[model samples]
Target: MHPSTPTITAQPSRPPPPPSPDKPPQTFLDLITSVLSLLLVSSLTVRSFIGRWQVIRTKLTSLQSSLSLLSDSPHWSQNPLLHTLLPSLLSTLQRLQSLSHQCTLSSFPGGKLLFQSDLDIASSSLSNHLHDLDLLLKSGVLHQSNAIVLSHPGPSSDKEELAFFVRDLFTRLQIGGVEFKKKALDSLIQILNDDEKSASLVAEEGSVGCLISLLDSHNERSIQEQAVLAVSILASGSDEARKTVFEEGGLGPLLRILDTGSMLLKEKAAIAIEVITAEPENGWAISAYGGVSLLIEACRSGSEATQTYAVGAIRNVAVVEDIKMALAEEGAVPVLVHLLVSGASAAQEKAAHCMAILASSGEYFRMLIIQEKGLQRLMDVIQSMPSSDTIEHVMRAISSLSVSDSTARILSSSTLFITRLSEFTKEGSLILQQISVSLLASLSISDGNKRAISGCVASLVKLMEVPKPAGIQEAATAALVSLLTVRSNRKELVRDEKSVMKLVQMLDPKRELVSKRFPVMVVVAVLTGGSGECRKRLLDAGAYQHLQRLEEMEVAGAKKAVQRLAGNKLKNIFSRTWRE
Candidate 1:
């Protein structure tokens, strides 16, 4: 290598005399601008040195590039991160100027004598600034923002413009001050609430980690409220957004807000919790962080909306089986029972659902609910006619308990419940009918409950007649089949020719998409226990041909009916035919 460059650079490349303050900087921006000028002057003044000095000049130019981009923004005055960064950057540049001067005056070569450490310090500071610059660039958040750029996609859209604006606000959220974060979050809420597309834009940016930080205890109440509100909006709108919030360690602060935040803030936090826990994979997170206990408290004392959302959140999280039992153990039951008795219509509905989940986790939980009189409270709410939704929730709770004989007895023994079930099957929505039929199916397992379900028999057959809602049709058949163990139910079932014909006609193999298993089961139930004339009515309605086709279709419950209807003489022929 040459001992020196072929030519000396500009005089600005050499170290200049030390800066003397002429006048105080009018503002922070002015101060940073003065320091930057000094750095450029000294960087060029060091033109006398080569190698290491060249490297420092390169870093100084980079720091200047990054900060200048930030300061170029029309709204630069409002950026707190820039305000904070400028002072540190100014100090770093001033130190570099001093270091350059020392290197120049040094008696030894390259400032190698006593100032080597200080030179290293100056180089390290420049490297730090370079690192900060890299972060600012990679954040995909330009401090110089809201100036529309060409969208990566072919055509520019206002939609794309809105997305660019959201990216800038997210940067503010990430590094802006308390008030900045608050304002950023407020704007985000407005944008997100305006439409779902705005929400998707923010979620695609994937930096919701700032939301968790804003939920920190030290933030002002207004800031925390806006932070959680933003979370609630994002969480409810997009799956990616929800996962982002969870991935960023947001659940801990969210649960903390739920525990200690003000009424409005708590409500916002609860909304986020309710939505996040809806994903079954995320259910365990609540109990993992002991949020379930906090939710239980919310159920006890949260506002109507809060109580409603909190109960929904608890219900959602209790889907994890281990957590299900843990939720009950955490005292969710009694509060749930209290909600069922006196909470608002919506809260009661959610509480009933949560109760059902907790009760169904184990026999121990069922017994615990019984101890709390939760079963009766559900029946009480069902009788109160709170809302169709509430009725369905209560019915679901009762049905969950009816899985066991002891609980089934408690449910079946309620005359009001049995009567309501009959009414629901006749007049309720498809969902209610399905639930009602399911309850009756479980209840009919006990002979005592069988007689009680006789009033529902007319409605069950009516339900089976409509083949559109196949779920209700299937459930109705199962319930009717279970009720067939009783003599009166079997008689009443065969008495309706229109109803019996509907069941037999559905067994035809031509209805390929229709599920024939449950319908066949119901037919077999009646044939086994009905009077001779009832069997004659089924045969007259063309049961033989349908059963033959269904048996060939390999429909379960069809073969037994084939043998029974074929009797002994034809049984051999039918069996041969079946084998062939």
Candidate 2:
């Protein structure tokens, strides 16, 4: 036993012989616990995936419900009765529905990742369709229902039918919402523009009063513009309509619009005022309302078109003497002269015409134009060789300026001014030619200027000899008379036998010349008053018969001039033959 104990001590050191390398074997309870842990993890994962699938299914169901409602809802298509009444409206509704469906599809669940481009395209298409629908509603063209009502045979005249439609539209305008009011006003404008009878009927139906009321009541720019535009269309070329507009207290609103409205509104108001003021009485009404100052202000600051209209209105109002003086006092001359150079072509033309009228008022206004450098502007227009209409306007303005001796001297002294005037007389339009020669005649009043114009004697002679307008003949003949007053210029006229013949032919009673007869006779008398050679030239051109024919007419100055020429000729022939 001692030996065994000793061995056991030694064997303990060999101990618990190295632990086993294999894992420990599980018991029934351990196995059950491991299986339960594995099953718990697997069940958690499966439940998570199942929950995700159910969430996706719920989203899909909600999407399907929304799509079903969008496609089937009657509210999506408003006013089915309207659609039935207008087949085109039905098409619009269908298109809108289809577009809405497309938009919905492109914007759902995975749209950001899959259908973003489709969404943009659908959105753009929808916007364009909406714009088209708006235009269709606002254009005021006849709808299918309106056409059907109009084309139906009945006792109603077309005018009466149109009137009924107009009344209906106006009723809608007064009673409907903003969109309906706009559409009705748009329709009224179109109808009034197309049919004169419709314009008259609308005016007679108190549309002027309604439109004026709308101008004051509606703050919408589009509505106000359409209202003013309707007023303009109704008043255009219709005196009674214009009177109605005035009587309906439209003038104050029109002027207010011109004073404070937007640019478009002001433009429309300007056009309306322009139409209404076409009648002189209406013009006085505008002036009486202190509109001249407003119009002048427009000329000073409005857009080019507005400026043109404003200047034109000023010119129309200036036909009244008091208004003319009022405009001149309001500093219209400088504004008009400013417009002459800087305005649009139409504005410039109107400005020049306005200048012509203002200049014709008196020397004060004439000098006003000159002081404002209007003469330079007129000359610039000539030098630029503008359109025919512009040329006529500028030339007329120059003629008006030339009425004053001081202004004529100022105009005649510009560099190449006489040459420019002479060129116009030589080869410009008939109006240009007339105005040019008239300017020359005015310049000829200065003894120093006659020498400058004498160089153009040939052009002057040609103008007289050519078959020209009576105004051209009158102006050219008057210039000749003025030029012949200078002794040095008489030789040029006496040598041109064609000029002599033209002067003699002007005196022929058979021609029945009124404006140019006296001037032509005076020039002939001056030319023949000199010597036997001039008288011989006249006699050879049959001046005796033409001059004798003038004696029978009731022209006092022409008769005296012809008699003086006859007396000189007879005395010279008698003296020369007796001496020979």
Per-residue lDDT tens digits of candidate 1, residues 1-580?
A: 7698577532223333333333222254566567667766766655334467778877777777766665554555543455555555566677777666655544334446456666667789768656754555555555444343222322335764666667667766665567767677777888778777656678777467766777887988788778888888988888888877777887888899889989998898899999888888888888889888899999888888889899998888778877877776788889889988888877888888777777666788888888998877888888888878778777777777777777777777777777787778878988889898877766735566577657777778777756665577777877888888887778777788777777777777776545778678887888775366656677778887899888998988899987777773365567789999
Extract clashing residue pairs from model 2: none
Candidate 2: deviation at residue 320, Å? 2.9
The whole-model lDDT of each prediction reads 0.74, 0.65
Off by over 4 Å in 2: 1-157, 387-397, 423-435, 445-475, 485-500, 507-536, 544-580
Worst 10 residues of 1 by lDDT: 146-155
The deviation in Å at residue 499 for candidate 1 is 2.0
Report the Cα lDDT for candidate 1: 0.74
Collision count for each candidate, in order: 11, 0
